[model samples]
Target chain A: MSFSRRIIIPLGFVLLIGYYGQAQSSYQTGLLPALNVNTKLNRGWSINFKFESRQQLQRGIFGEEHDQDYEYVLSDLALVAGKKIGFDQSLAGGYLMRFRGQDMIHRLIQQFTIVRRYSSFRLAHRIAADQTMSAGASMTLRLRYRLSTEWPLKGQSVDPREFYIKANHEYLNVLQGEDYDLEIRFVPLLGYKFTDSNKTELGVDYRLDSFLQDHPRQRFWLRLIWYRVF
Target chain B: MKYIFPLFILVLGTFQPLSAQLKFEREYRLKSREVPPAALEFMQALPFTKKIRWYREEGYQRTSIEAKTKHQSKRYSIEFDTSGQIEDVEVIIKWKNISAETRQLISKQLGQNHQRFRVRKVQIQYTGTPQALREFIAGTSDESRVTIRYELIVKAKTDGQFQRFEYLFSEAGEFIKRALIIDQNSDHLEF
Candidate 1:
């Protein structure tokens, strides 16, 4: 397929989904933006620092009284350390701090990742587990798996000044005391490589949760991400 | 605010050094008409009926055109310069294809250099005149006029640090030279 057509098809699909979302009472729309910095260390080790924030753009049911006012959501700061165990696999551990209005939450994370390279694209698999803690609340634990693929739009690989497409599908199983639920997420992104150490991506992150309950919830977020390496 | 963080990161990224020593390599697919006529002519003369894919590679201060295909269960890669002059032909082969003595020597050398090592790929490379290579590929010529070398991709641990390298060896399994294969950062995929 032509590069422009490839981009346009998915974009159109996302727009269609957005249009459909307006009629659903359980839908919420927001913006998600994040910045990440990665640094390499000695002996096949690396570190990453990330900051992310969320904001609500619109909410409520279609053809009814809806709240369209902007609202600030929450912020997250994370630090991770990674070790390359093999040419294609790595192990990592991290910590995250979340600030939500007057509440503060902490999370501990561990993950394993494997990446495979093909002639014209790359595929990645990740399995992770995390535990979240907050004052006066039961501990929550989540287990997740994600599969993602990336391919250059203009060449065999994504190089400086080139464009690429990345898509991810993930499933999460969550547990909090007597409660258990599942969430699924899909993200499709358009990325631009500024240089060897820098890149930016804009995309839509769609999540479906609460399906195990009586009222299922859906979220659509416009996501912007920036990555820098040192 | 959301705007402040992204702006700060963009400014920081703009200041990062573009080191001259960093290697830049890229490959692009080419249409049949986009390739040099001479290269296409040479390809047309081959007896193989398999589909051939053409590519243009830019790296190491030079650009080269490559044709890749599979024949009789073996993978073949033929490279040519920009002016359509043939450079080398490489065929992926098994480690057992090498003589037992040569394999022993190669293994000994690798064992001596690294605490742990694994061979990922092995390719036998041929370099000679176009006529000689054509005859060899056709099974009508001997190795008298054609030079043979072995190329291997290896991942090894040296001094407690692991790295990947591309190694070249002579026909007798004597070590020639090795180059480090720098991997692109994959933070986005991992995190």
Candidate 2:
């Protein structure tokens, strides 16, 4: 197949899907900014810290002919220690602190990741489980599975100052107070590696929460992330 | 219609896999400043430059520097040693560019050397001083003044095993050197 057909068709498909879904669901636009710092201590040991801020549109979901207003919804900071267990496999454990509308929650998380490469792209699989605790709310346990893929737009590999694309989907199962709910998320991102130590990503986060109060809730958020390596 | 589109997208997006053949090749990008000044200066002298990229490759014994660029609708790659000395300059060429005699010689050599082999890539290379190349590229010197070689990437089956090797041959298709690739590590995970 030609390069144009391989690229243009898939991109057109993604845009068509995004446009078609907006007409079906109550979609709200939000903003997320995140910073991630990674430090490698040795061949197997690594440390990472991440801070993210999430803001939601104040108006109703998909309100027309109105001024755009945004309000802070939540913020989170997390620290993780990771160790390589096998080739292309790693295990990480972390602690996260979240602040949402004057309420705080502490979470403990463990994750396992496996990555493999193909001709011009890479595939990553991550499975994680976390426990969340709050002063007044019930304790919650969540399990998540995410599959991600990335491809370089040029050359054999993604070089410095080159463009790439990433697409990922995640499934979440939440257990709280004898009740369980499920969530699914899709993200399509465009990324650029500015230098060996710096990179940026911009994407859309589309999430659907099923069985939330017996009704499905859909959200669309704009996500921007920065990565720095030390 | 409301749910069908999303369902179709979800199914298609989640299951579609990249369909392409992979070779045992990789590269690590380097900064322009990280390249040796003398080599960079020589390459920049070429005309109609579009893009210049630097890479570091640890092959066989020493670390080699590669500067890849596109000029006049053709790809040019120049290799240099640690001290900015020119190793070779290679350009993308068509398969028909090799003479019939040279092709026959190459096939005979491959038949004698391996049970079976497949060609993956080919490049026309020039081995000479940086100054001579600059003058040649600048159209001030004749092409015959510089020595030309052929670089071929082939997957050869030897002793009932298939392995990829980089092969160099003289203009007359006489075998010169062959380098075996031990690993395909391109710093893919660091970023």
Candidate 3:
């Protein structure tokens, strides 16, 4: 089969499944847009600033009344500092402030990452721990591990004016008060590199959560991300 | 809230013109059919028949085709011109594979060049006539007709900053030239 067919067929199948699954499961669809800016410092240190916003377009429970009205959800602003620990490994810590309606939540994050480079693709593994605190709520602690891979659609490496594919699979273990749950997420993105330090990606961010509950919830977000490095 | 959209657009617009000054370097995989017939034929003449992958590299004012494979547990990379003529063959080897004298000379050069250095990869490169190269690999001929060189990927601390370089040395360990290896942006992955 041709390369385009290989990619297009699976993507179409997933979208079809998502469309059909709406009838059998509770689903929420939204738009997630994010911007990340990175700056390098001396002595192997770097800083990153990120802003992300979520806007809901549809929400409903299966077999019930569905709401189609657009709603603004939440936005997050984060700042992170990282230090290179090895040739392909890094350690980072960050703080994120989330704005949802009149409430503001704070999150602290620490993570370790390793990036492996192959001839055709690059794979990244990340392990993270985070604590989220909100007004009038107990703190929520979560542990997460994610594996992501990126490959050039045309060549061995992604270069300026090139397109690439990036996919991420992540598992989250969440604990809040006396309750615990697991959430799984998968993100598949098509990216375009404008320069060595600039790129954009568009993709689907799918999440399945509330695993320990009687009813599970699914979210499908059309995600757009822009990354800039200096 | 209404002004945010326009502000974001303005910010993006300001960066668009800066992209023209950036550099471009890329290496991508190629199918067998995309490779030149001469290059494919050269591979066919080799005695080792393991899985071979082809790649096309563009950057630095040059374009070249490379074939990579593993034979007898050693990784081999053969580079060819765009027209499919053989340029050189490189086989991954250990530092100990170099002769004692050559190793000493190489160490001396590296010590003088950097405050501290570590070799990440070492490859033995061979260049010769196509026929001679094939025979040399097949063990049918000696090294008389082939020119041998050592290629090393090294990470060294120089002037308080660490950088990665690709170094080329003669078979006898005389330093020839070196080029800095540019690293790709990993902001997306790291953050």
Candidate 4:
């Protein structure tokens, strides 16, 4: 398999159910943009309401956008906590939920993520299970190295903010009687932060699929994110 | 790609300041000298008081002041045998760019908060990520730096004289909790 052909093979025809939860362009997102509202009730607990009204705009691995018509509303309550073990051991976790009216269909989901930070970069492993009998896992390996020239912009000081561009890659492998598999995203990002809590990110997303040599489809988007105090 | 240890080092180093907490112990020491009538007359008039004992750890600020009263008949010890007695006295004054005038003006505001705000061991905490903290508050964040300052302070009066009027005027201004001392019986101090 040529490199591009290998990449598209999975990008075009993905296994029955496989999503790494990248929060990027989706077959259902173009028609129904989603709204997420989260607030801090106190210290350890938080409530998040999600309203998604768009369909996925799947722009095959390379060519045109394929409209995947679907919508659902999801309400997720999360309990987050971090524990430090010994001198070099630490753990951070989030327990989440999905409700009906949040995005379109009435479905529930549970996702668990665990990460380990080394001297240079952090590695993440995530597992998500849907109401249906489909279960999947995603593995992401990203390298974050600090750059010197970038100072922080105004409006951020309460937390330590760092500037680094990372190379991100994800893979999803599923099993259900037969191999319905493959999809991957290769993104190079130019990211910056204001204080420590606010973020401004920009990047290019390159995708590859399975069947029609999942054509190499790419796009650009900007994202803004804020986290509540813990 | 470089040293994985360095990345873990980065995260661990960020949380260092969270544990550098401050502890305030209760203690105080008081001294006075009468030029002619008032201070002397007050000491002399006291009945059955023992003379002074010059001690370093007894709460005296300096040995020079301790020497001034050494062997002098006027020197006397005032001891309050309570468990939380003023063990040592220190006056720590912090000159922050705080709006003292603004706080004074908020007297009415505090009155309106009669239900929400109550007196207790006050601890003020600020939580946010370095990147976001500097962005939300103007001039707070570096281009991509994180390390915001969080501070806590405890203050009490020098004499515990909450009700009286005159004790408030003494030149002894200090952060009573961290700097000054008070006797539970000193009706002149307000905390």
* Top candidate by DockQ: 1
Error of 1 at A129 (Å): 1.2
Q: Report the lDDT of model 4 for residue B86.
A: 19
Candidate 4 residue lDDT tens string, B121-140: 22222224422432432344
- Give each prediction's root-mean-square deviation over alpha carbons: 7.6, 15.9, 8.2, 25.5
Report the CA-based lDDT of candidate 3 relative to the real structure: 0.86
Pairing residues by index, what is the TM-score of model 4?
Answer: 0.31
Query: How high is each candidate's TM-score?
Result: 0.85, 0.54, 0.81, 0.31
Model 3 interface DockQ? 0.36
- When 3 and 4 are scored with DockQ, the better candidate is 3
**lDDT of each residue in A41-116, candidate 2, tens digit only:** 6656678889999998743433345345677889999998887665456788999999998899999989888776
What order do you get sorting by lDDT, best first?
3, 1, 2, 4
lDDT of 4 by residue, A80-166 (tens): 333322112223343434444423222334434433332123334444433322124232222221111111121111113445443
Best by lDDT: 3
Residue B34 in model 1: lDDT: 93
Clashes of 1: 0
Query: What is the lDDT for B58 in model 1?
Result: 87
Give the candidates in order of DockQ, highest first: 1, 3, 2, 4
Ranking by TM-score: 1, 3, 2, 4
Q: Which has the greatest TM-score? A: 1
